[model samples]
Target: MGGESNRSLSLLHESQNKINSSKDVFLEKCL
Candidate 1:
């Protein structure tokens, strides 16, 4: 159960990073 939670956390972190980077790029373009 702990291992499964850890994997989920990492996947979430990765997806968050991807979303943040994409947002940064979009804001840069807008500016």
Candidate 2:
């Protein structure tokens, strides 16, 4: 159970990072 939770948390963090990077790119283009 602990391992499963850790995997899920890592996946979520990765997705969030991707989203933030994309947002940064979009804002840079707008500038």
Candidate 3:
């Protein structure tokens, strides 16, 4: 019942979160 889609969605969400975290770290270092 759409388990594969859910898995991919979660993976994408995690990757987006990682990108956001890295961006935040870079901004903090720049400040």
Local distance difference test values of all predictions, in order: 1.00, 1.00, 0.98
Off by over 4 Å in 3: none
RMSD of candidate 3 to true structure, Å: 1.0
How well is each residue in 1-31 modelled by candidate 3, as lDDT tens digits?
A: 5999999999999999999999999999999
Residues 1-31, model 2: lDDT tens digits: 9999999999999999999999999999999
- Residue-level lDDT of model 1, residues 1-31, one tens digit each, is 9999999999999999999999999999999
What clash count goes with each model?
A: 0, 0, 0
Kindly report which residue pairs in candidate 2 clash with one another. Answer: none
Worst 10 residues of 1 by lDDT: 1-10
C-alpha RMSD by candidate, in order = 0.5, 0.3, 1.0
What's the C-alpha lDDT at position 14 in model 1? Answer: 100
Predict model 2's lDDT versus the native. Answer: 1.00
Worst 10-residue lDDT window, candidate 3: 1-10
- TM-score on alpha carbons, each prediction: 0.87, 0.94, 0.92
Residue 15 lDDT, candidate 3, scale 0-100: 100
5: Cα error in model 3, Å = 0.3
